[model samples]
Target: MDLEKPSARRQEPEGCLVVAIRLPVRIVALLVVVPVRMAWDALVVAGRFLNDTVLRPLGRALLWLGRAVFVWPFVGLWRYVLVPLGTGLAWLGNVLLVVPAVWLYRYVLTPSGHACAWLGRGVLAGLAWLYARVLTPIGHALMWVLKGLGAVFAAIGLGVFGALAWLGRYLVVVPAVWVYQWVLAPVGRAVSAVVTGIGVALYWTVRVLFVLPAVGLYRWVLAPVGRVLAVLGREIRDALGHAWRVAGRISLAVGRFLAGLFRWIFVEPVRWVYRTVLTPVGHAVRDAVLRPVADAARSVGRATRQALTAARDSVRQARADVRRMLFGEPRQREAVARREPTGRETRTLGSSTTALTKD
Candidate 1:
């Protein structure tokens, strides 16, 4: 059988057909509404593109120029001008504050020497006034006490001196007087008696000798002996004089010989040895010993420097090796690739990335 036509089978009343026609009217309204919405969306996109492409760059340029002219100038001025000005003002403030205080302190605090002189004069005047008003009575009182003490001391001193005087009289003076009278007086009288007897005998003997007429005989005997003795004394003096001259000559020769020996042995030999041997020997020893020591010190210093250099190099190499072992070789290839520009290659890569992102 043939399928019935959908339009022929539909049994729509006039009012329902009118309603279906109104549904088409609503669809037509949507067409105008969708177009208006699309137009509004397009205006928003255009406005954003205009702002980003034209206004944003202009604003950035204006901001950069404003910073260069205004902000940067002010920063330079602050660093170079305003800062120093402010510092000078601060220094001036400090000087103004401190100078007055210093002046005030100098004015208020008096110098020690001047103040001390004034104080000393005032104290002396006050002391003199006090002494004039009160010291006489005080002095009298002191004198009275001193007088009483002096009287007591004098009484004690007199008692001591009296005892000493009594002891002298009894022990010293009386014993000395008794010894002089009893012992020394008898000895003196015996000496006087012996002396008087010797004088009497000597006088008798002199008288007897003088009466015998022996003076001429004594003169005759002694005259020949005196002549003989005078001759002997002259001979003895001549012999001593000759012996003294010979001894003086011998002493002069010995002294000359000893002086020549001393000059030869001590002075000339020592001079020759010092000039020829000791001075050269001392110089040679200094050069031989000190030169070798100085060279050895220099060699040691050079060796130490070389050893330190070798150790430093070894440490640096070891550090490099350790770094390589731990972190491996750095990716210098990536850095080199970044440094080496290939324009077509970069463009191809950018296009491929953009295509992938779009897909």
Candidate 2:
């Protein structure tokens, strides 16, 4: 038929049918929807962010910044500079006041020493007064507050728990304890003792009536059956072993048989035909077909060689005749033959011999 039809169909597998479909519209749909979906998702994210973000303001941010700028500097100054200056002034005053008193025995109540000692005593008295008046009272007040709170909580807990416990004892706990002691405990013990007695009796009955008989049956009957089964299993195993060995031998024999059959049916005949029939037929065909060609080639070669020899002889004869007419020589061929068999003479003699053999 037409070979081009199938090849054309194969090359343009989707040409017209694919083009007729609205492929461009589908491509446009895909391209347009991707960006629209991305834009919609972006809007959703922005709306979610705005839901929380729209309420925050600059006031809280600036409040912390303002504290850092104003309050932190004052804190640093008081801690690093003001505290050190105050401590140094207090130390100088203490040394000026107390040192003179400590050395009063050496000064012997001199006015300057007395004044320094009095100042030191006054400073000490003032410190004691400040501690007694302010710090002691503050500590007492804190202790009183903590003690009052602890006592109040203890009283409340004791009262509420005492009332609830009394109520529970009256309503639920007393009756439950009474019932357990008088009813459930006695009943449970009696039932448990009875269950134990019955279980003991059942255990003895089964051991005496059923278990002993079953054990005796297994010892006498089942054990002998088991021994017989084991003997049968051994016999079956030996039989299977013999069958397996025989199967292996059969497989080997089948493989040997198949090999011999293939040799006899196919391989030997092929070998015989190639050696005895095809070999001689090939030789005979070569003799029949090629020998004439070789003979014709030899004949053509002989004819060419003879013609050349004759041409040469004629030319030589003409030359000799001309020479005789002029200078005279008739023994060219004889002289050539007597001189020696050169390449030209050898080739001519070989051609003559081949021609003679062919004839």
Candidate 3:
């Protein structure tokens, strides 16, 4: 059978009904969508303003408050209270449990283990000696006696087995083979033939009554109807999509016009007032008032710092005088002699200095 190529499949021509339906549908969709698109754009702008002015700051404050209330206490407990407690517990366990365990293992258990191990080795050696010297000859004699008895029993068993086999062949095997060949084989063949004939007839009856009609209905009626419905749905979807995009462009142009009008009326005037009026006023106020106040504050801070330094020195001098009056002067440490000569008494290059002559 030859298969059709993809390009060989032709598109159905659009009828007048579809063309008529499309124009009205698209017009209705565009009118319905324009208002919805503008509303959506307004909602977007409002949401952004609300987020920037109110919700974002509120969320930050809530986050900080939550950290203070919920997170900081747990962090402080882990860092300050629980961490120290755990450290102290670990130290106490090392002192009370680990130290004793180590000592007991080192001094007590080690010697006891060694003694037990030595004892076990001696016991094992004795058991090994007993097995090697006492048990070997007795085991060999017993095995020889068992081998003689096994040979005598084997001869008797073989004769009995042979006689039973001869009887079974004549009584059981020959009769079973005869029945299978003459009686069962013919009956089985007849039953199989009847079943095969019934199955063939049933297959053909079901095909004629049910399967053929279903296939014919799908090929002749249902497929064509499905194709028509699919084309109509595709056209409707395309029209709606095209209308929505055109509405969005129209919404964008309207938004730009409104924004320019608002900027000209409100924002530009506010900017002009700030630039021409408020800026010079603010600069004049800063130079006339704030500069004098800052200079006086700096001078006051310098005088205060000098007074504090003077007071600190006076207090230190009084403390020293009180100490001298009460306990007298402190004793000075005595100087010790050194192997190297002092700087004032050092030898010059003209002076002869040897190890023997130095003393």
Candidate 4:
């Protein structure tokens, strides 16, 4: 091998010269893209896994904290304190104020409304019933009279027509019959025989062609069809009634189910909440807040009573002092002696003694 040409170098192993020169570029590319590739695949998976493991729980904890911080206090106040207090207040108001008002309306206005409605209904019913009882019968009687007159006229016309028919039969039919018996009978007997034969043939043809077939059709096909139709109609009517009853029952059941659903959705939940959650919380709040308020009120009331008693005593003392200052002392009559009686008074006493001794 010639050492001057680059491909024919025979001293390649001396300085570790390899056939390929891609190792540096590959090492550099790995050094550059390894982090990016890891970020694209493994980092994303690690991020997702970490999110599920740590961040999601942290988010849930934050949500719970938010709910506890914001929602719980109001819920407590609304359910525990405000609801019971409002219920009590509403009960008090309803008992003291609303019930009487509702009773007044019920007893006063409702009866008046009912009376007015009854009066109006009675008036309307009276009018309608009066018409039905009196006017309708009168109208029916008048109509019957008019129909009777019409029938009488129709009978007269029918009787006139019958008389005319009888008169014409006597005037023409007897003459024609007499002529046929005397003059035309002998001449037309042969033709009458031929006509009689023709009539007999036509009669037989009608019986065979139309009457017998009609009777057979009526007996065999039409009668059976009518009977089947009647049975089908009866079955259809019975099925319709049965279906109506079933539909009614289903509707009743559905109504009951809907009522139960409403109770379950609304009433039962509220009852459970009131029983399990609200009742306990309300009792706790009563112990915490209302008891203290009641104690404070009692203390204040005692203080007020003591103050009022002091004031009342002070007023009585002031009134007694005013009475003593306003009223002066008066002397009694027993403290002074009587003046000596005059001679006239002594004479009067003597006269009284004389009268007493006489008595």
Candidate 5:
């Protein structure tokens, strides 16, 4: 028995129109895109080379120089100069503004605030007493007088309101209700029925005259045309994309050939010269000339340093001798013994020095 591998997906059937359109479009696109792809690859290679060879080093050097020239000086100013200046200004402000303000608040403003608070409390107490003893009684008496007058007015108002309600029912309300029930109700029903009929007829006429034809035109004509246009667009896009990718592969092969040619022609020879010619020449020059000069300079620096040391010693000896002759030998200072033991005379674990543990 033979086993067949399962297919990942099924292929769609293509029409003659799609096959005809795809081939020519892809051919033309390939012709147009090959040069552009090649040029793009060349630009990418040049940008990479320029970045590695020149721009990266230049940017690093500029960054270091900027730190030295601009950034470091500003940092030093902030750390050493501006920081101290700001601290001094802060101290001065504390002395001039903060200290005095604190003093004023503590000595002058605090006492004045206390006095004002006391005065406010006394005034509030007096207002409270006045409201309770005098104003409250007067207000209650006035309210009692107003209540008696309101009761009398309310009785009069009730009588007048009842007469008005009786007159309104006969003169206005009853006539309005009779007119609505007998005249307006039938007229409104007739108008509403006529509007309902007209609305129904207008809806059916619009559906037959406009809506059904629009639906049929869209379904039969526009939708099919739109589908055909969409298929064409999709095919053209796929062809262009396939052509671009094929062109890029061709461009890559060409680029590789050119790069190999350039390396063989230029880079190999320059590398050979640097390795074979320049390296030997530089080593010979360093051994023959630079090494001997460096040795001689080191010898001269050693001799000069020794001579300076001897001269300094001689000057110090002469100063010492003159000072001894002038002062006629200085008296020796008397040594006084300290209570603490010296390093060699340190107490062992078995030994004791305190009064309670003396041995």
Candidate 6:
């Protein structure tokens, strides 16, 4: 049997069909997902850029501010407070350990057989006693040797004193007296005579050679000197007088010129300044400062004078009052004298009364 000719149409496999559907789905999903993934990635990149540009800078600024505010205080607290406290704790722990060790050493090991303090005291006492006992014989021997040396020295000293006394009389005193009388006294007399003779000779020689001749020479020389000096003095005086006349003329001319210049330049303006500015300013300053001071001084002087006068018057018045009070008024002065006793009269009467009473 002949088969019919197969047509050119191809049949789709089931797997291929399924694969095609899945591929479409996957392509669509990928197409959508790619853009979403890209957008997500862009968002992540932008977020990172923003964070790097803005958030990082802000964070750094905040961190710097935090450090500025807190770092020094924290460091100070750590260094000054915490560190010291820790060191103190460590030192206290060490001290606690050492204290007990020292205590144990002092209590137990210092004197292992007895109480340490009493044993130490007793040992010290015994050492002192032994030292004393050892030194005693040495001290006695030293004393005995010193005593012998002293006795020897004393004997030597006594012998020396006796020898010196004898030598003073024999060697020094009599020799000194004999030398004074023989050598010094004769030498003094000879020297005095030689000196007197030389003085007289010199006086006569100077009078003859120097004084008389010098007077003649001076007189002879001074005549010519006086003549020359007089001429020179006259010449100098004439020259000085001419120079003074010239200087005076020149100075007057200069003064006239300067005065003319000053008058041309300054005198009128200066007069105005003196009248307006300088005079007023000087007067104001003087009146404000010096005048007040002068016034105050004058017032003080016047007040002082017045006070002195018042004091004098008060003293005088007081003296007069006292005199009046003591003596009463002038009218009663004679009465007062009469009432008071005279010393001579009272003495005479008392003498008579005493005589009569005695009789």
For residues 212-289, what per-residue lDDT tens digits would candidate 1 score against the true structure?
A: 557665677777677656655543443344434444455456657877999998999999999999989988987999
Clashing residue pairs for model 3:
none
Q: Count the backbone clashes (under 3 Å) in each candidate.
A: 0, 2, 0, 0, 0, 0
Q: Estimate each model's TM-score.
A: 0.22, 0.34, 0.71, 0.28, 0.72, 0.28
Ranking by lDDT: 5, 3, 4, 6, 1, 2
Models, CA RMSD each: 65.8, 43.9, 7.8, 35.5, 6.1, 57.4
Better-scoring candidate (TM-score), 1 or 3? 3
Worst 10-residue lDDT window, candidate 6: 17-26
Q: Pick by lDDT: which candidate is best? A: 5
lDDT of 2 by residue, 1-359 (tens): 11111234334343453333334434444454445554555576678777667634455677788889998999999999999999998899779977776678566767777899999999999999999999999999999999999999999999999999999999999899999999999999999999999999999999989999999999999998887666556444544444444444554566578779999999999999999999999999889988888999999999999999999999998987888998755566554445434565454534653456633
**Candidate 4 — what's its lDDT?**
0.77
Off by over 4 Å in 1: 1-32, 102-359
- The digit string of per-residue lDDT tens for model 4 on 4-74 reads 11345464342222212223433444455444453454456679999999999999999999999999999
Model 1 TM-score on a 0 to 1 scale: 0.22
How far residue 281's Cα lies from its native spot in candidate 5, in Å, is: 3.5
Q: What is the lDDT of residue 345 in candidate 3?
A: 50
Instruction: Report the C-alpha lDDT of model 6 over 88-174, residue by residue, as the tens digit.
Output: 998998899988998998988977846767779999999899879998878999999999999999999999999999989998999
Q: Scored by Cα lDDT, where does model 5 land?
A: 0.89
Candidate 1: worst 10 consecutive residues by lDDT? 1-10
Pull out the clashing pairs in model 2. Answer: 323-328, 324-328
On a 0 to 100 scale, what is the lDDT of residue 262 in model 4?
A: 99
Model 4 worst lDDT window (10 residues): 14-23
